[model samples]
Target: MADITAPELKQRLQAGETPTIIDVRETWENEESRIDGSQNIPLGSLPDKLDELEELKDQEIIVHCKSGGRSASAKAFLTQQGFTNVRNLLGGMQGYQQS
Candidate 1:
């Protein structure tokens, strides 16, 4: 699937669509700023979170990071692990803030 642009995501959120959103930045980065309602699961810890996220395997999941790099990796990893609808937020938080 194509990655979601920050402006597109902002519109969805404004429309009240509640897709499962994950922030793949570090704990401190997440604390500094985040999309409301997004779950914080640092990229380094995603392997350990498989069990907790198993039930959401088929659900749409949006992942973002400081500058899109980490979240892209997260999306790739999740897709490989059988998460059918994982998408990386393009440009990540930096883009989101600009949007």
Candidate 2:
């Protein structure tokens, strides 16, 4: 899976382009902090949640978790599911915070 650094993602979002951003963190972790406009779908539930994101399969989808691990998994899963443009958020929210 390709990676989008926090800073790069930040810039795209700030420009107001609507990239599909999925947050794969737990509910509690997301409740604490998250990138605005990202959808919350825990990593464990992603397989079941694909239907909800079908419209995004052909679009650029950015998956993120606390520090990139879960997002990387999500990216691979999405790609296998026929999502051609899935990208993992590098360093996840931790890197976003630093950026």
Candidate 3:
């Protein structure tokens, strides 16, 4: 899976290149703070949510969580599941907020 830094993502967003942003964070954590327009599918629920993401398999998908750990796992899972374009947000939301 490709790794994207939070600043690069922010620049892309600012440039109006809106790739699908998937927040694999838990519901409570999502409520605390999240990037606007991101889809919240908790990490544990991702397997069941494959249908929801089917159309996005060929699109650029940027996965993120509280930190980078969960996002890395999510990226690995997506790759194993045959997702063609997946990326992990380095440092996750913490990095995004910092940027």
- lDDT-better candidate, 1 vs 3: 1
Worst ten in a row by lDDT for model 2? 1-10
lDDT of 1 by residue, 1-99 (tens): 778999999999999999899999999999999999999999999999999999999988999999999999999999999899888999999999998
- The candidate that wins on lDDT is 1
Q: What shift in Å separates residue 48 of candidate 3 from its native position after superposition? A: 0.4
lDDT digits (tens) for residues 22-59 of candidate 2: 99999999999988998999999999998988888788
Predict model 3's lDDT versus the native. Answer: 0.91
Q: After TM-score superposition, what is the CA distance of residue 13 in candidate 3 from its true location, in Å?
A: 0.9
- Most accurate candidate by TM-score: 1
- What are the per-model numbers of colliding residue pairs? 0, 0, 0
Tens digits of lDDT, candidate 3, 1-99: 568998999999889887899999999999999998799999999999998888888889999998999989899998888899999999999999998
- TM-score of the candidate numbered 2? 0.95
Q: List the residue pairs that clash in candidate 1.
A: none
Residue 86 CA error for candidate 3 (Å)? 0.4
lDDT of 1 at 20: 92
Ranking by lDDT: 1, 3, 2
